[model samples]
Target: MRAVTYDSYAKDNSRLEYREVPDPKVGPGQVLIQVRAASVNPVDWKVMAGGLDGMMDAVFPVVPGWDVAGVVSRTGPDTPEFAPGDEVMAYARKDVVQGGTFAEYVAVDAPAVAHKPAALDWAQAAGLPLAGLTALRSLERLGVGPADVLLVHGAAGGVGSLAVQLGRDRGARVIGTASERNHAFVRELGAEPVSYGDGLTDRVRALAPGGVSAVADFVGGQLETTLAVLTDGGRHVSVADPTVEQHGGHWIWVRPDGAKLAELAAVVDRGALTVEVAQTFPLERTGEAFDASRTGHTRGKLVLVP
Candidate 1:
C-alpha cells in the first residue's frame, strides 16, 4: 500500500512523504477499507507535529488522517455490520495514531463505520465524517432546539459551516460569524451572516436583542464575545477551548460513532446537507495539502484522492 507517513514529529510537513508501506491488518470486529478519498483537518497536521503527544499517544511512522470515505474490501472475523463491497465513511481515529486513512488501505472498527451518503461523492463523503461529527457534537452539547437562537463563531470554516446548516435543521434561528467575503456563503448555508470580530457581540445583539440562547465557538478565543452575547443561563460549548468549562460552558471532542455518522448521511441524502471542497490533491501531494490547511484561509475542505 502507498501511504503518506512521518517517522518523527517535525515542525514542518517535510517529514510527510509518499512511500510504499505494509498493508493494514484487519483485526476481529474491524473491516479493511480501500481508500477512495481522505480529507485534511488541522488535527492531522497537529498530530504529525506532536501537538497531541502529551495527551493522545502516537506510534512512530504514523499515517496521519482520520476522515475517510472508501469501499470495504474485506471484513475481519465476527464483523457482521458490513460486507466486502459496502461503501463506508468513518472518523477512524484510534487510541494510537498508526495506520490511518491517508493510505490506500485502513482497518477500522465496525462500530466507527457507516454507509456513505448516496447523495455525496467519495470526496464529499470524505469531508463529512470529522467535520460533521464535530458540528453535530457541538449542537448536541449546546442543546439547541427550535425556539432557540444559535450563534456560531467562524461559521465559514469546515466545522462552523456544518454547524450552521445543522443548527438550522434543528430549527434554531442561526446566526453565523464570518469574514465579510464569506458572508454570502454563510447565508447560503441557512444562517444569517454576521461579520466576525470588532463589534461581533453588538452585531448579534442587534439581530437578536433578547440575546442568543446558545453559542458554539468553533474558532476559540471567543469567550468574551460569547459571554457578552449569550443570554444568562443559556448554553455554550467549544471544541477548541478547554477553559470553557470554567465559564459555565462545555468543551467537546467528537467521538467515533457510526450511528451518528449515519444520521448525518441521512441529512445529506435528504438534501439538507452538502460539502464544499476548496481543493483536491493526489496522495503523493499530501504535504502541499497540509501547507494549504495551515494557511487557515480556505472556505471549504482540502481533500486527498488516493
Candidate 2:
C-alpha cells in the first residue's frame, strides 16, 4: 500500500514522503478500511513535528493522519457491529503514533468507527470525524443549552464552525469571533459574528451586553478574551489551551465514540449540520495540504483523496 510517512520529527513538513508501505494488520475488534479520503488536521503536522512527544510515543516512518472515510474491506474477530462493504468513517487515533489514515488502508477499532453520513460525499465525511467530535465534546463540557448564550473563539475555523452550528442546534444564542473577512461565513453558520482583535471584549459586550453564558475556545491564546466576556459563573472550555483548567474551565481532549459520531451524522443527514471542505489534494500532495493547514486561514477542511 502507498502512504505518507515521515522518518523523523522536524520543524517543517519537508520530511513527508509518499511511498509504498505495508498494509495495516487488522487485530481483533478492528476493521480494515480501504482509504477513500483522509482529512488533514493541524494535529497531524504537529504530531509530525513532535509537538505531542511528551504524551504519546512515536514510531519512525510513521503514517500521519487520524480522520478517515472509506469502505470496510474486512473485519476482525469480535467485531459484530460492521461487515465488509460498509461505508464508514472514524477518528482513528491510537495510543501509539503509527498506522494512521494517510495510507491506502487503515485498521480501526470498531468502537471508534461510525457509518459515514449518507448526505456527505467522501471528502466532507472524511473531514467530519475529528473536528465534529471536538466541537461536540467542547459543547458538551460547556453544557450549552437553550438558556445559555455561547461565545465561540475562531468561529470560522474547522471546529469552531461546527461548534457554532451545534450550539445553535442546541438552542443557544451563539456569538462567534472571527476576522472581518469571515463575518458573513460565521453568520451563515448561525452565529452573530464579532471581530477578534483590540476591542474584542467591547464588541462582544455590544452584542450580549450582560455577558455570554458560555465560551468555547477553539483557537488558543484566548483565555483573556474568554474571561473578559464570560458571565461571572459561566462555563468555558478549550481544546487548545490546558491552562483553562486552572480557571474553572475545562480543557477538552475529544474521546472517540462511535455512538456520538453516529448522532452527529444523523444531524448532518437531517440538514441541521454541514461539513465544509476548503480544498482537496491527491494523496501524494499531503505535504502541500499540511502547508495549507499551517496557514490557519482556510475556512474549512483540507482533505486528501487516496
Candidate 3:
C-alpha cells in the first residue's frame, strides 16, 4: 500500500512523503477501509508539527489524518454492525496516531464508523465527519434548542458553515459572523450574516434585542463578542478556546462517536444540512492539501482523493 508518512514531528512539511508501506491490519472490533476520499483539517497539519504532542502520544512514522469516506474491505471478529463493501465515513481518531485515513487503507474501530450519507458524493462525505461532528458537539454542549436564537462566530468556516445549517434545522434563527465577501454564502446556509469586526455586538443586537439564546464560537478571540451577545444565563461553547471556561462557557473537544455521525448523515440525507468541499488534491499531494487548510481562508472543506 502507498501512504503518506513522517518519521518525526517536524516544524515543517519537509518530512511528508508518499511511499509504499505495509497495509494496516484489522484488529478486534475494527475494520479495514479502502479509502476513496479524505479531507484536510487544520489539526492534520498541527498534529504533524507536534502541536498536539501533549494531548495524544504519537508513534513514529505517523500517517496523519482522521476524516475519511471509504468502503469496507474486511471486518474483524465480533464486528456485526458492518460487512464487506459497506460505504462508510468516520472521524477516525484513535488512541494512537500512526494509522490515519490519508492512506490507501486505514483500520478503524467499529465504534467510530458510520454509513456514509446516501445524498453525499464521495468528496462531500469525506469532508463531513470531522467538521460536522465538531459543530454538532459544540451545539449539543451549549444545549442549543429549537426556538432559540443562536449566534455562530466564524460562521462561514468549515465547522461554522455546518453549525449554521444545523442550528436552522433545530428551528433556531441563526446569526452568523462573516466578512463581507462571505455574507451571501453564509446567508445561503440559512444564517443572517453580520460582519465580524468592530460593531459585531451592535449588528447582533439589531437582529435580537434580547440577546441570543446560545452562542457557538468556531473562531478564537470571540469570548468578548460571545459574552456581549448572549442573554443572561444563555448557553455558550467554544471549540477553539479553553479560556471560555473562565467566562462560564463550555469548552468542547470533539470525540469519535458513530451514532452521532449517523445522525448527522440523516440530516444531510433529509436535505436539512449540506457540506461544502472547496478544493481537492490527489493522495500524493496530501501535504499540499494541508498547506491550503492551514491558510484558514477556504470557505469550505479541502479534500484528498485517495
lDDT values, one for every candidate: 0.92, 0.94, 0.92
**Candidate 1 least-lDDT 10 residues:** 293-302
Model 1 agreement with the true structure over 106-176: per-residue lDDT tens digits: 99999999999999999999999999999999999888999999999989898999999999999999999
lDDT tens digits, residue span 1-306, model 3:
988999998877899999998989888999999999999888889899998999899998999899999999999999999999999999999888888988999999999999998899999999999999999998888777787999999988899999999999988899999989999999999999999889888989999999998999988889998898888889899888999999999998899999999999999989999999899899888877887877777898999987
Tens digit of lDDT per residue, candidate 2, span 1-306?
A: 999999999878789899999888899999999999999999999999899999999998899999999999999999999999999999999999988999899999999999998899999999999999999999988889999999999999899999999999999999999989999999999999999989898999999999999999999999998998889899999999999999999999997888999989999999999998999999899989999999988898999999
lDDT of 2 at 303: 98
Q: What's model 3's TM-score? A: 0.97
Q: How do these models rank on TM-score, best leading?
A: 2, 1, 3
RMSD of each: 0.9, 0.8, 1.1
**How big is the positional error of residue 55 in model 2, measured in Å on the Cα after superposition?**
0.4
- Name the runs in model 2 displaced over 4 angstroms: none
Error of 2 at 271 (Å): 1.1
